[model samples]
Target chain A: MDFQTILILAQDAITNSAIYALLALALILVFGVTRVIFVAQGEFVSYGALTLASLQTGVMPGTVWLLLILAFIAACMETARLLVSGARHKLPGALATILAPPLAIAALVKICTPLHLHLGWQLILTMLIVIPLGPLIYRVAFRPLADATVLVLLIAAVAVHFVLVGLGLLFFGAEGVRTPPFSDAQFTFANLNVSGQSLCVYATTIVFVAIMAWFFNKTLYGKALRAVAFNRNGARLVGITPHLAGTFSFALASAIGCLSGLLIGPITTLYYDSGFLIGLKGFVGAIVGGMASYPIAAAGALMVGFSESFSSFWLSGYKDVVVFTMIIPVLLWRSLTTAHYEEEE
Target chain B: MKQFLASISMLAVLAAGTAAQADITIGVNLSSTGPAASLGIAEKNAISFGPSVIAGQKVHYVIYDDATDTTTAVQNVKRLVSENKVDVLIGPTTSPTSAAVIEAVAASKTPMIQLSPGPATISATDEKRKWIFSAPANTTIYGTAMINHMVKKGVKTVSVIAVDDAYGEVSTAAYKTLSEPKGIKTLTIEKYKRTDTSATAQVLHAMQGNPDAIFIASSGTPAALPHVALIERGYKGKIYQSGGAANAEFLRVGGKALEGSFMLAPPVVVGEQLPDGYPTKAEALKFIKAYEAKFGPRSMFASLAWDALKIVEAAVPKALKKGKPGSEKFRVALRDAIEGTKGLKGAGSVFSMSATDHSGVNQLGMSLMKVENGKWKLEDHAEFK
Candidate 1:
């Protein structure tokens, strides 16, 4: 490859990797802390997009910033209510608790018609609503199932997926809901042409990811959540209630997914079914990083993103067949290497 | 002895005359679900319209649902012929299933009148295959006519995005043949399956090439509007929608986004003056008025079905009178009536089908329309010169 071409492709890969990284990392976060594989995580991404689009447009007008804040607040509140209610009379720890967040969102959306939302507003609303989703789902569904086997929680995740899809179709008709375009402005750097909205997406993902990393490393609650992810029972023994920290982890993870949703709308049009593909792609990213490590997961996402961009550039027609085919072999190699790593440890 | 012999002779003549009538059965396989439900529904309704059109004919109808699958289509054709004993068969809406049905019906030596975009399986070259017929323009005709229009508009560079099935592949092939020599350069070409929702990446690839025009080949709702996002991205390039998006529903969903967008399709009534004393035009307006009154004013497919029904109606009576029910003579008469039709007016267009061409509307009358006032309004009618 030419040096300039390589450089440009690398930049494009980095951008692609970052978007995938955010979604993958968020998915892993919910799983790592709550031990519940939340399948509805993808739906939250779509919900975030639709929400933001609705709020920013005069279709459901308020100040952009205000709408974002309100959407975020509403997301967290909804999560809390769902988790609390789902756990009310159930067995203290069951898989059902881990799925409550998605269930709640589905119910909420099912009850209300999708607002005719603009693309920008959709981005904002979806992002705002996603911040608290992970925790809410974890608190209700996974917390009760925290002590349950991984397979059991996996089954619960599948259930969450069904509910999310069913509700998405039931509420938003099984067709594309178009969002109007953002303003047109382009910035060229070197050989790459970047649009104004795309730059915002890149910047937002970075800022959000950085702030999250900082919060995890520095804050008391974030530290508690990390501790729980490290050793759940141990954290409980040390005076941290795993239940609350688990919820927080889920919320934070879901918020990241929401961020991915908001960022995607301007660059790509979205529909209810669009979430499943991205979600599956994120899963690939998470598995590439070994699924247990955030930094590594992000690295894997970057690698996948770069490879995709590279394939698209060099072998455009076979991009899909090339990218998807790589997944099986990469996964096998990763698993084999991780086994070796564990043996060494 | 003489009287007895005369009576015996009279009884034998009467018995032989009574044995001459043979019953003919026609099988119709159509979709009841999936994206083409409305089209299938109208066509199925047209089956009923057949009896009404021929007020005195009693032809047996055998209808089955293909359910929009190829395997099911093949199965249904066999069922209709072997079990239902149909002498003739029609339909299976889309190209893929239509192709399967055509092959099966041809193999069984049963005459079939398929409703499809003739490109998927049976081609004009394959017309010698005998016992097969199409009631729509082959992809070659559509692609050639559409290319001719583009060439007329001075569009020399074109980009194509379409579903990656027989219809898209064939249409693209035709476009390349007709446009390349005319100095039309195809910059970006992409294909997606009918089920794909994410056209962003593919469309983005197409936009990168920066062609003067884009041709979206897929007629399904999913493929229709993703280009709108490309338009939003500040691309002012002309978009030539295929014959598929010419439907009113597609326009309604695309709304203001589709304003001034052009299409290549058969003519539909959009504020055109009716010819005096044309029965089809009056019937179409009445049906439209009734449908709008009952179904909230967006009844576009109703008229097309009504026309198809009228075709069946006009054929049935003449066929019934020409031969007894189920007779070869009766079936042949029906075919002649359908094929010989000319200048028969309907709600959408004045239609005529000939033995050489099953498509009622011709390249001579392709309807060109533009999105105006949030609805599809006919801009002009073009005849191949």
Candidate 2:
């Protein structure tokens, strides 16, 4: 490849790496705090992008109904748990928190749809509709099995992924949709032209990463989540509820996944089931981090993006096989370098 | 007269006491919820307009969503054959699933009206295709039309990128086979997964050759990715799509970037623009009118499904006279009747099925179309043969 082509392909890989980095961080974050593999984490990306597409077209997004339905189920589960535990006093507040966001968002979507709200409002609305789904998923599917083995939780996560995929098809229909780019402007540097959408992705990724760094190091809930990540029983002894930590981390993960979707939506067409492969690539990056370090995971995702970009160029037919096969070596190094510990369960 | 004939067949078909013969069941397996849903959903939606009663006996369609997975498609085919006792099978849409279910259908001796990518070259000696007939134009017809078009335009070098599946593999092969003999040198051939979110590497690789033209051999909206990416990079050469992106959605998805690109759509899609002497024009106009009247917008895939049933409808009466509807003999008769199809009007093509040619559509079945201002405009009424 010539210098210009190399530069262009690198640009493409970097744009992809930005999104994969977010996904890796989300995967790592969820796995750390919840001990759940969080396989359905990618579904949120489809949901976020699709919901925005629907909203942009001035129609009520299917996410509104999905959110309400899931919210109702979450409310019932939380209500049932509270009654069983004799925490009846906490029931009203818990129910309000569980049920209100989806209902309010549904109402907002219904109200604002015909108004043909601008893209900014629509994006915020999209986030509002999809973000709560994270915690709600935790409540309905994961929280009930909180004490279960990681394998069981992993299976549940996969099942949830399939269910979400089916639901995505129902809501979004079979045809994929692409949103207009955030900005259509082009930038050129040293004979290399870059798209505005790529810039948007880069800016958003950096800002989100910085915010995540700050949240983990500075905020109380973030510290609680970190404490929970470090030691569940130890944090519980100090009055940190692992349940809250799990929900918080899922929320963060979903937010990251949703943003990744938004970032990548304009760049390509995302089908109902596109997120799994994207998320799997991120998981490969997480493996690069040895599932422990955020910085290494992000860098690994860049490596994956570069390899994927270059390999597809060199050997287009075997790109996926090449990209997925990357996990083997990182896994080998991981197994060889890390000291094995007794089973956590 | 129709009612009288129907009543006669219904009465004759119902012999309750001994292995009671009943409805002419057509088992449909489609990928309505997965990657191939673009093709499957349209076909599924068009099922509502299918003829309910053929030759005076009720036609029962046992539709199942195979979710675009081959295993699920095979299972559905089994259930449709053994459980439903279908007289014929309509789908297992998408090429891989269609190819996968061929063995099962051949085993059960049920005739299928294949709806996805027609194989590039069906060997006349192949026994498996005996019970199978396709609804759409095959890869050879598409590849030939595209190659001939490129040849007409004096294009000497080309690149091809297709989905890394049964359809793409065959189309890429067809391009190389057809284009090379036509004096066009293929610079590169690339493949990407159908469910892939991006085609950066494939696009970059394809562009590296800087060939005179690029042929994207994928179907549906996914085809738009490389097109859009190519446009983004300001690659100003001609881009061609196969018949797979005939739907309006491909145009919508790709939007402004797709303008001026060429695609080979079945002549039915551009029926109004076709010359009156064309065989499929009248039926094409009728299907477009009827389908759009119900569904609002016209769809190419939907018309493919409609045309499959048209062939089935034409064959049923002749097949009905031979044996009872549920009998294996009736399926055999149906298969024979379908194979005997000659000069029959369909939405996609005037099918002329025979012993050797299952999807008996020639180059005339497809027309060269281009995206002009985000809509499919007929470029050449391709009668290349």
Candidate 3:
């Protein structure tokens, strides 16, 4: 290939890698603190994209209603628990917590949707609508089973994925929707011309990664989360609440997933089920990183993007097969190198 | 007195059963809620406009959603044949689903009219296609038209990029077959999955060949990926697309990147732009007006479905003369009547079905369209062979 061709192909790989990196990081964060393989990480991506699509059309998305319902259920569960324990004072607080956010969000959506806000504000609102479902779902489905084995948690994750997919169909129909690009400029350098959307994707990914690095290294909450990941029982004994860490981790992962979806929406037409395949690609990257190291996961995701791009050039029909087959070698190397240990009852 | 009442009741029950059997049923299996739902929805809307009464028999439609799944499509066909006992069947909107249910339709001896492009293998011989008829023009006719246009333009080398699916495989193969015989060199062939977000590598690889033109064989919004990639990379060669991209949705998603691209589409796509002497122009315009009035827009798939129902409408009266619609004898007569269709002008084409040719629409049924100013316009210089 010529130098220009090679450069263009590399650009494609880097753009894809940026999206995959976000997904890989989300997977690692959720799996580390919660010990759950989040199979439905992709569903969050679709929800975010479709939510933006609805908002663009000036309609109140079904996601807003879903969030309201889930929050109400979670609040009711907490309230019921407090009442059963005869903690009458906490019941009022529980009710307030459960009822306030949905009411506020609903009112905001009701007022702003018809005004047809700018794309930037619509995207922000979409993220705000989607991010809380992460923690609410945890409280309703996963928190009760926090002490269960990883296998059971994995199955629950798969079930959650199906529910989200079905809900996605209901919200967004089966037709694919494409969001407007953040910018419409085109930059030409020598023989290559780059779209403004690609530049936005790169800048956003870099900024988010840097911010995450600072958060994990400098913040107290981040340290608490690390402590939880290191040893849940020990963290609990040290006065760090494992439940808080779980909620925080899921909330962060879901935010990252939603951000990735927003970034990708303008670049491609996305259907309700598109997220599963994209998330599977991210899972491959996470697997390569051993699901622990953020930097390694990011690098692995870049490798996946590069491999997919080059394989499409060389063996176009088998590019997906090639990228997916990469997991086999990484698995073999890990199985041979890492020591196995049983959990203590 | 009790015996007399029982005998009268039995006679009434028999009469009711006979009346029910006399009603003609048209079974419809479509992907109403899956990846191909847009096409299926449009087709469903078109079929709803079908005549409610034909040949003094009340026409009843039994519709099922296959969700674009192969197994579900086959199951729907079986149920329609065994349970509904439909005299005629239409659709399962996508090509893969349509192809999957062929054997069941044939085994049940029911006449089926598919609303999408299918492979020649499903109707390669008269015996194979005895009970099946395709509504749209064959893929080969589209390929031949495109290749003929290129050959006339003095193009020598071409590259192809297609989705790695049945539709892509069939259309690309047809292009190669037609182009090769006409002394055009196929430089390279590349494939990608329909869900792929980027086509940079495929486009870059095709650019290496430096062909005169590139053909993209894909459907819906997926068709825009390669076109955008090629334009961004500054490859200025001609781009041609398959008939599947002939829809407003494709144009809406593609935007300015699709400008200057050429496509082979059924004449119904540019019905208003057809020449005054065109045979199917009046019928096409009438159908387009009715469809757009009801659905707000006319799509190529909707027109295909409209034509499929029309073909069935024309054959019903002839079949009614042989036997009542519920009987197997009537179904056989209907199949034969459809096979004998000649010079019938519908929305998409002038269909001429014969014993050996189930896909009766030929090259004349197609028109070359150019994407100009974000819309499909008829190319005046298009030569029909």
Candidate 4:
């Protein structure tokens, strides 16, 4: 109600909004290109945070093993399809492509984890362990169903979410972990106190937001993905493989998720299942943008964060209820403003 | 062939009769792989060290993971009672899981020893609750200890930020009930979900009163969220934590922010720091030595499991005399015997349950602890009514 309280809440909102904004961008990107609403996107967040925590403690992270498992499964799926198609000559190369990265990463993790390297190395290692699951998942679960209906893909995404959550619990244990902050500096602005970490989060989100805009508007790969999102079959006819676009988009989404996790891990405690609610919030933001526009999605996520912070003050127990309900009006408006057309599907 | 078949049938019948009489099956349901997995893992590790032979009968533990879900807990309890034919049930590690299976335990006439940290886990007013006994120190006792500490520190007004669950409901109510009589006013009450990542709004709202202290009534590591938020907001007042948030993970997460906070925990938390002649000193030391040696570090949550065994060790022999291990009479007798537990000191607390008081742990079982240099140190303490 007062200025100071408002200031504090705004600061909290901005810090939280940065995380949600990052996630919202990823959700939009993945949904646009992959045609799969990646429900398991948030698992990458927890995996990234917990993997870093594990490596920092000089322990072998469970993600290394998970990556290997995903790699092996993907290899089996690819190899079987090639052999059934009588492409025996492509089988060995296909196997190496699918299997080699995870195997090499697992070896690197085994060697570097015990060395108790600096924070930068630990972070890079965490990303290395977690990022491959994006494409591997696409290969193993989504690729087999790539041409399936959206409903089928959505169902598969949910199933993958559960599997990842279960594996998260098994790999990371149930207790939540908070990493040591990257910087402990405190900033006293004109009327507010912001930590260095919050500033870091804000800077990182801005940089990524800029990067995302550039990637979508300026890059060739991004244009290919845009064409695929526009029309999958038409894009394929024009020499843009829908599957390649899907895999690339998934990789980008995974990297974004990993970055969001790394950013938020020091700010709050994160459990194996914590990513669901946060990711769900991001999905809400994506819906506000009609799940298509990146800039709008980021803006919507900030709105969600600010509204959540404010409502938690008034109706703290109903914070989630209030935030989730905001989507209804936006949805009604989206339906009213947008034209309904015949589906390409 | 006919003679051989008849002899085999006779041998099987005899072996079954002897095995049933010689071993008492105990069913344990804990959330080993879900939200409450931290508590369950600790309890499981400690319970595995329970006495395998009790009162000349082999003790068989049929353990199952309920995954911290109410439905899974009900299913596990039903299967344990119907199929395993357990004489007594030992767990359902969290309050939600424990509360969900009360009817199943009562219907099957199985005695249940609950290892949760809420007084609301079992209500004496409920008829079915007679079959269930609580093992951990009641959260109200923890609230009392915290309030007493506040009084000593001359705190007048307090705010509470609790989890929006039964644990929080019971805890905040207890704080109000205890604090009001001491002339300390309750300024604001706020609640947040355990998975909530931000408590900035709640902290600001709670700070509106500018109370002398703020009590966090949350379970496990989640308590650290609100606590850290308050500290980062530059609030100068004292911060207090409930015994439910006594785990080392809470300390680890809260880190430097928790340096001066107070927590009411069982004596087992600072067992080595416990003064001589404390009620749970001997048992706490024994537990710390053995548990830390094997498990590397001790989770005070493990004491809930350890205390359950202490109750069984003290009560089972008396119940065994009433009937055979697998019979309905033995279970009823075991329930009655545990309810009649008096002055039995265990790893975490002193247990004394009665028909009307399922959790009879008093102030003596709890110690006021302060976090100094990342470890719990027992304070020079006084008692409260």
Report the first chain's TM-score for all candidates. Answer: 0.74, 0.98, 0.96, 0.98
Q: Rank candidates by DockQ, best first.
A: 4, 2, 3, 1
Interface RMS for model 1? 4.6
TM-score of chain A of 2: 0.98
TM-scores vs. true structure, each candidate: 0.72, 0.90, 0.93, 0.93
lDDT of 4 by residue, B243-292 (tens): 77787778888899998888888878888887678778899889888888
Per-structure clash totals for the candidates: 26, 1, 0, 0
Which wins on lDDT, candidate 1 or candidate 4?
4
The order by descending TM-score is 3, 4, 2, 1
- Local distance difference test, per candidate? 0.63, 0.85, 0.86, 0.87
Candidate 1 lDDT tens digits, A142-190: 6567788878999988886776566555444344444443556877777
Model 2 regions more than 4 Å off: A338-345, B1-41, B44-89, B100-111, B120-128, B312-334
lDDT digits (tens) for residues B1-385 of candidate 1: 9999999999998875554234346688887555466677666755554442134433567888877778988999999877776656777776678767666776665556666656345433454334555555566666767777677788878878876666677777877887887889998787764433344445666666678888888664555545664564456778877776555546644656677777766553452333335334466566566555655443334455555555655666666678665555665666666666686665555567655556665553355666777766665454423
Each candidate's DockQ: 0.11, 0.64, 0.58, 0.65
- Model 1 residue B220 lDDT? 45
lDDT of 3 by residue, A1-345 (tens): 879878888989999899888889888888888898999998888888889989988889999989998988898789888989999898887788777887888889889999999988998899889998898888888898899999999999999899999888887876667788889998988877788999999998899889888888899988888888878888889999988889988898789888888888888777788888888888888988888888888899999999999999999999999999998998999889988876453
Q: What is candidate 2's lDDT per residue for B1-385, written digit by digit as tens?
A: 9999998888766654232355788888888877677778789888888888887888878899999898999999999999988988888677778878878988999999878765532433577768887888878888888888888888888888888877677778888888777889888888888667678778878887688899999877888888888888878899999877787778788999988899997887878988877878888899888888887777778887898889899999999889988899899999999989988878788788778888878777888998887777888765522
Candidate 2 at A107: error in angstroms?
A: 1.4
TM-score of chain B of each: 0.76, 0.87, 0.92, 0.92
